[model samples]
Target: MWREPWPSSNRMPFTKKRKLQLSPEQCSDFYADQYGKFFFPSLTAFMSSGPIIALTLARNNAIAHWKSIIGPVNSTKARETHPECLRAKYGTSDLKNALHGSESFHAAEREIKFMFPNSVIEPFPSREGIEEYLSRYVNPTLLHGLTELCKHKPHNPCVWLADWLMKNSPNKPKICDGVTVEEAE
Candidate 1:
């Protein structure tokens, strides 16, 4: 996203320019300072990086749950991390802090449009979700948790996961009912 003080049609000032110059990491720090550290480089960077906010979340509690995960506007003002709060880690500055979850369902629809003008926030879309999720979840380890899940039960786990997926996931199934790990391999 591009952070210009004035509208694309209007002339702007230098402060917005400075805000724009922040590297993704510095931006992350800035937002982390606000408690956006655990959310979507911390959302503070992304917000400060641009003038508007947008999201095309799924129908399943995407807005409300995202808000819960985002935590309060003030990280210090909040109580628990909500256990799954996005701000528990990523937030930093209030001005540049991460995430502005839609206040209501209607707002989510409107905000999503403003944040995403094109068809959707798909791959190679206007904003960046891949980098966002990474900054939120990555640790020092080389392997993500999935590596252990893969190693522990390549055979049994797939079925377990497939069932869970069938029960809870919106994404389609990849592994067939009769397919074996060897076949997959």
Candidate 2:
């Protein structure tokens, strides 16, 4: 999972005391009329009270897996029904559930764009095919290669990373196929 800075517009949804500043129409639109009116204020407040960390994760059936791990939307109910789930273990109540999972693949794509506007996420090949998806779409970049060292190899990792970055840094000029600024005209 990778962390991203929260969007500034999220702050407009609630008050300092964590009360929602939304109209009934807005609440319906946001929640898709799934939750009751009474819950909307607290739900919005909870979501907007502070900066939220956005994460990108990959796995077979990722959406379903993540939803299952988070359990029910109501944390108290999750604790009684799914004691092993993340919300059941860490959440205090429905209003304070600690995680959010996308409910569908389309929703996940849209949400990813909303959180990280410049992200380059490809459409999924198949929800059940993890290996094929990874091989086809998830090529290891310089950053990913360096990060993998901690898991696959840990000997002198810091030195290895420093050396790798020095070799790859764009500050050192190299021959290129594209036109330079001087030749563009």
TM-score of each: 0.35, 0.50
lDDT, residue 168, candidate 2: 57
Q: What are the RMSDs of all candidates, in order?
A: 17.9, 10.8
Per-residue lDDT over 145-175 for candidate 2, one digit per residue giving the tens place of the 0 to 100 score: 5676666676788887777666654445544
| Highest TM-score against the true fold, candidate | 2
Against the reference, the lDDT scores of all candidates come to 0.46, 0.61
Model 2 misplacement above 4 A? 1-36, 126-185
Looking at model 1, residue 21 earns an lDDT score of 47
Predicted model with the maximum lDDT? 2
List model 1 lDDT by residue over 20-138, tens digit each.
24455644543343463356444544655544423344545565665665677675554353434555454555544344556776554444444344544433433367666555544
